[model samples]
Target: MLSDTHPAGPGAAMRSDEDFVRAQTGIAPVPFVPEVRLHMAEDAIALWETTETARGERGLPPPFWAFAWAGGVGVARYVLDHPELVAGRSVLDLAAGSGLVGIAAALRGARSVRAAEIDAYAVAAIGVNAAANGVRVDAAVEDLLDGDGGPAEVVLAGDVFYERAMAARFLPFLLRARARGAVVIVGDPGRAYLPRERFAALAAYEVPVVADLEDAALKTTTVWELAGD
Candidate 1:
């Protein structure tokens, strides 16, 4: 199981729009700003882009991906570095936070892309951002581990190894997908649950992340990828 020192408790599960907003801008770290390009998915759920001021002290802020989380950065870097991997394949982006990876796949010419996420707000955010980017993707509010996934030639997972419960639920599914002849790729930056032996390193990058939400601009995060065992 994965483990982390980050607290998880009441009001922990993004309960309010304010919480979402606070997450986006109140904690701006000095972003490393990679040159990775993205292609938005049209069929993905769409949510308005919200900023600290635009939220007006109410409504939800954008999701983690909107600001480009660590995992997203790593995946984006991989796609930009190796565009040919997705040029003509069907892709499944699991735990599709902000739908960035999936969008990248579509942008790179994937025949089809699906962004699967369980959070309604995240799903909506993905749809909105996907439209903004002008790509086509199917968005579904389902967990692949819950037996809700469909067949795809490739699967993308980003930063999902932070929580033990999540890792437990997700790893087996990824292994299963691998056994089924699908390419399973995960971008992680030393998350506790990442099974080093089960994957082969593909790439690495230094991504900026908020070390302290209150202090925002003081941290640099390292990100990496595991393409296969």
Candidate 2:
């Protein structure tokens, strides 16, 4: 349990996105992917509680940007180690939490990096994190999956298969991107809903994670490419 004092309740007011994230987080290196650093929160649950009160609401989305998730770390490490995979190519980091994967791509010399996250707070966190690493990642708070892949040569998604409904929506979007010649890659720690048949493993990593956020302290994450594309 991480702790913070922001605000809560229906009457509490909202804070500026960038200021709130920056104020609540500190710059630190992700354990597995040390090549890039982010202004991350100390505790995932604490940040979520803070955000709920800060916006005067309950049931707000979790503060995923505060922590470096295992799946993101695995994909980011893969991207950093294999710069050639994205160098000089446009990339889309779907559900770009803290923009870690997108930042890795930008640092690795991608022609362009688009980090799309539906959570406004996550979007702000991505912008701050990118600046902390001295990289340019365009952060958009939109549901890009609702439509087709927009002009990206490669698509990198981290931990998007956590739930059945989310997996259903994500797999279809990824297949469409693959069909259009974009290389679609996903990093997952063997979540129950992942469509294993649709992906081929490219690399695997034992990513360190916070206990409060996962069932295990380490996540055996793997980067997989959409198969039969």
Candidate 3:
């Protein structure tokens, strides 16, 4: 959702995370995924600045957890419409900014859902967002990319191929999962690093996004499945 270049930067290890999210955002439904509601900020830059001041820190990763990204929204739409792909399966939302995709899986009746983020604050926001959407999503501050294939049958990753280092690490992890018989899917708004040739498009959507964050009112996002070798 956010530009990978955005210099950014949470809470307790939950309560304070919720408190901070509440203090910084307003509850609203994502325009494209109205089935879910999230605490969001209107101005991405302003919110990031305020977050820095509130936490008395600088150089924090952007408040990516505060907003719904176009990619995540698109992937969620596809999953909701194609419930059979995720229903009754174990799902993992890797690099889950707000746990949108994982929540969608849960809402679609996935047997279990885990949403992972490297940021602790985002981890907390995930919990709050999951509760608001009335879905039970397990939140963890983890680097799922650091391991071999996980146990989840389906893995949903949003906008992860924007940066070279991350993309490099993420793609191989996804391949490992695919090799293990996991269904790996990704939602990307054509980020620079997406390895298009390796994935097959499943769906596309014109996702509404914050102009401040995306520099455009809408972005065409695509859901792509990693091909198994």
Candidate 4:
């Protein structure tokens, strides 16, 4: 998930978002979804510091776009395995950090894919990562939580329930999308704020993740479909 801050920082004038992301990360295969590759950071703390230094700012959010979170990994794996869910459909990847899930949708033959992120750096990472995977994903820096989830037939959200405030807003947005006939899906690693009662579990997987980031080497992530009221 992303923070409310949107500034690219003062130093952003010197280096482009794509260039900063490339400089801080290395292209690598996702642990659980090896079929797709992404620009990943080697050290989370170091990269976070680097991003802050480059932006000439402190107290910025960590580089979430530089790692494949377990929730996102599980969602990407499910989409690739069950291509029927997104095949020939327009997909919206909400809070699409690293564009992992959206890229998977494209690889599985989604007619169109759009990855939405509030952070400009994440948007740039999405573009570069999609290109690395040989897929076309339109990445935009925008917050969609306030709107009826756009015009996509399939809506994918990963790791979005980790925060209380974000979860409050996101759950209603997802419910609105589902009510409007959009197929809404979410991938979560048992975050405290996830309203489990609002969704039905569709699939589960033991997703491998960076120990430094998740505290555990593996997370039991589940892919869920929003249930009707």
Among these predicted structures, which one has the highest TM-score? 4
TM-score of each: 0.69, 0.92, 0.92, 0.93
Instruction: Report RMSD for candidate 4.
Output: 3.7
lDDT per residue, candidate 4, 1-229, as tens digits?
3322333564452237788889888998899899999999989999988888776679988799999998899899999999999999999999999999999999999999999998778999998999899999998878899886769999999899999999999999999999898999899999999999989999999998899999998999999999987
Residues 72-120 of candidate 1: C-alpha lDDT, one tens digit per residue: 6677567756878788999888888667788778878899999988655
Mind giving the per-residue lDDT tens digits that candidate 3 earns over 87-201? 9999989989888888889999999998889886788788888898898999888887867448999989988988999899999999999999999999999799999999999
Runs of candidate 4 exceeding 4 Å displacement: 1-15
How do the residues 91-158 of candidate 2 rate in per-residue lDDT, one tens digit apiece?
Answer: 99999989999999999999999999877789888988888899999987789877767699999998
Checking candidate 4 for backbone clashes, the offending pairs are none
Off by over 4 Å in 1: 1-66, 213-229
When 1 and 3 are scored with TM-score, the better candidate is: 3
Model 1 accuracy (lDDT, Cα): 0.62
Clashes of 4: 0
Which regions of candidate 3 deviate over 4 angstroms? Answer: 1-13
Q: Comparing candidate 1 with candidate 2, which one achieves the higher TM-score?
A: 2
